[model samples]
Target: MNRPTTLREAIEAADSILIGAGAGLSAADGDHHSGPVFDARFADFRDQRGITDAYSGGFYPFPTSEERWAFWSRMISLLRYEAGPGQVYADLLGLVSERDYFIITTNVDHRFQTSGFDKEHLFYTQGDYGLLQCSVPCHDATYDNEKWVRQAVASQEGMRIPSELIPQCPRCGEEMTTNLRVDARFVQDAGWAAAAGRYEDFLERTCVDRVLYLELGVGMNTPSIIKFPFWRRVYDNPEATYACVALDASAPAEIADRSLLIRGDIAEALASARG
Candidate 1:
């Protein structure tokens, strides 16, 4: 059978579906880390600091904390708060909504939840954009950051936010940081632990069944977490079908016969599969 036909049949026959998503999925939704959108949203930062992309801008050493918060607040607002879930995610939901499905994603944008995926069936291994934690990490806890981010985006002027608006850790009065997993200090609170447990339970219950391992836009940045594991499971379970839709997806020679790798835009590939 042809690849797309094979993939459709696999999905139709599987007992459950497990989705692994990466940064490319978000890129397909127009939240690319670089290019015209980056330039347009952060032209001032690019001209002043020579920081070209959102990823690099996070590390730029602004002279003051106020200036740093100014940069981050706007970035967070644009990427997370203001940018609602896009069509790609909605199309993905349409494809899997009828099936027993679980999602584990490295994307921190909260797109899965925003797109109406059940929270109990979703696990975000990385932290989220809508949260803040103590920089020194006095404790394993996270605070909702929407109000502060909105304030910063509105009150910032001339590359600096109001000094008084800078977030402080309530426990120790230290500076606050985004809940992104930049280092070992990232907080994984009770909610994070619960989600991780749920993902583990889902895998345990479904891995031995006729599962469809659907990976989307996964790259090698953190292969151990999703990519490598998916390949290993498919190799171990003959009944499991491995399928990937990405701009740079490939199956290893060992699993080539049992895998379907579609190299194309993620949104288009999903739409075709849903059809």
Candidate 2:
């Protein structure tokens, strides 16, 4: 979908637009799966394992879970919490911040907020890598991971992290785990709860407006969050327009009745939106 000729027509008629973004969107914004950082950082992992890409380096499979956590802790610090803020995320914020919009994303990188989306309007459905939660889920609290992560970086030696930040459950005094919600045990920290409330409020209020459900960079991996719900809403609301921009994007077979499928890059699509 090159810049749409009817761009103004689309937004002018749209009472509201809910932006659902994912890793794919970031890819277009200049953050791909692998780039210079991964190239250099995983040189060690590659030499030892005869592989390529930090993604593969991460899944190299160390002997112990402790070793795995150590590797991941550093990775998390670099990827999720401290990316130093890039241009792509900033441009994305510029693209949508002015509009009547709210974002729900599963990406744990925290780029949306880091680049300046209002924290109140953005909901990170997955737990952020910048936070730590109980592995056994002994309690509801999610401690600030930034401090603990920095400690790991400072104390690590010979490929092992210090025992101090072994990520134990603060409530039950068990091993602390990544705040990612991979399973039922994943803890929803206080921030997560508040974000969820805001997300619910957005849906509750926007459902009444003439919404333009903008689904960007979302794929089948987790269809429920972006694809299914948005499509359902579009189907229910005659005034709604389901505009999805993705690489080789296609909606559910049944959604053919009311959907505008734009198959292309997000930057190009946003340029179309800007038109």
Candidate 3:
């Protein structure tokens, strides 16, 4: 049988599904870290600072907190609020929504939540654009930034937010930063811990069942988190199947027979599998 048909059969046969997603999934959905949208939204950064994309923009060392918050606020609004969960995410959800499934993703955009996945069944290992934590990490907590982000995006001028709008950590008065897992300073708040526990629980409950480890658009940026784990689990569980759909896909020879590798467009592969 063809790869997509084989993937369809695997999904149908599995008692539970575990989805692992990465930046490629969002990129395939046109929500790239840097692209036309980034260029258009951050033209000033591109022209003046040579900061081309959201990914690099986050790392840019702005001279002032006002400038830093201005860039970040707009980025959060654009990536987290303004961008829609494109057809790729929706299509992927459609294929697994009817089954017992859980999703673990490194992408910070919250696309799975936006695409109608149950929040309780999803684990976002890399934090979120919609959350902010102290740069010094004064406490183990994150603050919601939607209201502040939209406000800053509206009130900013000259690529600087009004000094008054800059978020300060409520506990220690330190400056706030995106809650992404870029460094050791990243905060794992109560919600994050709870989600992690639930993910572990899901794995324990389903480990012996006929599980399908479906990885979508995952790449080498963080193999240990999803890609490697999926391979290891499939190797350990004879009843399990491993399927990967990405622009590029590969698997070790040991589990080659149990692996269904589809190297192509993610959306197309998902559609074919669902058929």
Candidate 4:
């Protein structure tokens, strides 16, 4: 059978589904890190700093914490708070809603939860845009950053937010940074720990069953986290089937027969599978 037909059959026959998503998935949903969208949203930064993309802008070293927060707050608001969950996320949810499903994604946009996926069954391996932690990470905790981010986006002037608006860590009174997993200092708070445990538990319970490992838009940036592991799981579990729908989808030669690799738009592939 063709890859798409095989994928549809696997989904229909599976007892459970595990979805692994990455940056490409978000990009497919119009949440691109670099492109016209980034240029339009951050024209000022682009003009001033020659920062071409949201991802690069996030790592750009500003002269002051206030300036950094100004840029980050606006970026977060555009990508997270202001933007609605895209249809691709909703479609993915529809495909697995009736099944025992769990999502493990490297995306930090919080789109899965926003698109109505059960929070209990979703694990965001990367940190979220809505969280902030101490730069020094004096404590294993994260703070909700919506209110401050909104305030910065609203009040900043000339590419800088007021110093008073800069977020401070409650524990150590140090400047705060986004809770992204950029380094070892990334805070995995109680909530993160719980979600991690849930993901592991879900895997243990379903890995041996007739599970469909559906990988979407995952790339080699962090293959070990989701891609490589899913490949390994499908290799180990005779009943597990591996399927990937991506712009560039190809399986290893060893698991060629057991895998479905659909190279195309993920949203289109998913919609076709659902039919």
**Which numbered prediction scores highest in lDDT against the true structure?**
3
Q: Give the distance in Å from residue 181's predicted Cα in candidate 1 to where it truly belongs.
A: 0.9
Q: Lowest-scoring 10 consecutive residues by lDDT in candidate 1?
A: 1-10
What does candidate 2's lDDT look like per residue over 1-275, in tens digits? 22222434555567777888877777776652477776575555456655465456555767665556666777777786656556556655666677788888977787887787899988888777788777888788877778777778777765677666577775688888777776899888778899899988888888867787777788777888877889898777766777777777776666565567777777776765565
lDDT of 1: 0.88
lDDT of 2: 0.72
Sliding window of 10 residues with minimal summed lDDT for model 4: 1-10
Tens digits of per-residue lDDT, candidate 1, 1-275, equal 33334556768878899999999899898884688877887889999999899889988889999999999998888888878888899889988899999999999988888889999988899899889999999999999999899999899998999999999999999999989887899899999999999999988998788888999989998999999999999888877889998777798887787788888888887777678
Quantify how close model 4 is to the true structure by its C-alpha RMSD in Å: 1.7
Clashing pairs in 3: none
- List model 4 lDDT by residue over 125-228, tens digit each: 88999999999989898989998989899999988999899898898898998999999999999999999999999999987898889999899989999999
Q: How close is every model to the real structure, measured as TM-score?
A: 0.95, 0.87, 0.96, 0.96
Which 10-residue window in model 3 sums to the lowest lDDT? 1-10
Error (Å) of candidate 1 at residue 72 is 0.9
Lowest summed lDDT over 10 consecutive residues: which window, candidate 2?
Answer: 1-10
Stretches of model 2 off by over 4 angstroms after superposition: 1-9, 49-61
Off by over 4 Å in 3: 1-5
Clash pairs for candidate 2: 3-272, 167-176, 168-176, 169-174
Clashing pairs in 1: none
